[model samples]
Target: MHATTPPPSTWWSRNWKWCVPVLAALLLALFAAFVFGILMLVFGAMKSSEPYRHAMKQAQTDPAVTAALGAPIQAGWLVQGNFSSNGPDGEANLSIPLDGPKADGTLFVVAKKHAGEWRYETLAVNVDGGERIVLEDDAAMPLP
Candidate 1:
């Protein structure tokens, strides 16, 4: 007598009646993750800087701005995220915030090492109709 293979058992099985709830759960998890990812990407790094924290709070509740980033931004502006060589050959970063619709939001960045110096290729990002946040003068204070 020939032996018959029982059947395939997996998420994509044809007889997946028992998998509706499971599939639904998995899909829900995936959707949640997608949403969280989008939120993080849109908000940029949620690092713990006192200024940044304050900015975020302001951004959320500050009446004027629906939300605020740790700092403001400039168009075609480039500055080091930290105090470094200041030679434009180190690390650079910028933060921008949007109140609504993620599709129209984007962050700008430019990092490069040139002549033993760091240079920013691009800095500052913006929304369709919004003002760029201004980075405090002491935002990039050198570390003693």
Candidate 2:
């Protein structure tokens, strides 16, 4: 009745092949999740910036913008485009409610990137009466 310890059971019996793929998959999934989270944060920041918002606030007070869209009673902003590179041009869609006289519509704002900051380049507003007002930064020209 000598039971010989069952031949010491080889290392493969520990299921390392399955474990390796499982661990690799887990690591890959974690890497993907981390990359995704980082991208979301970056895009979120680029989509809207405090500087842009403050600029919009200031623009609302401008007589030109108010003259085109009437006194801005309320407003909302939406930043568009992928800002993955330095000096990437961005656009923001502005929805503003006017005081009166002019029917409210969308305002398309084009902004530029300089020294890692955003600056207003052009602003355009199209109203219901086929009227459009465009404000541009004549001092600065967009690079071709």
Residue-by-residue lDDT tens digits, candidate 2, 1-144: 877656676787788979899999999999999998987786567546643454455546666667766764344433444333345544443333333345565455556555655666556555657777665544355677
- Candidate 2 matches the true fold with a TM-score of 0.41
Worst ten in a row by lDDT for model 2: 91-100
Name every residue pair that clashes in candidate 2.
none
Best candidate, TM-score: 2
TM-score of each model, in listed order: 0.27, 0.41
Maximum-lDDT candidate: 2
Tens digits of lDDT, candidate 1, 5-81: 98777666865776788899999999999998886554444334233343334344433333433224221222224
Total clashing pairs for each candidate: 12, 0
Clashes of 2: 0
- Candidate 2 lDDT at 126 equals 58
Query: What TM-score number comes out for model 1?
Result: 0.27
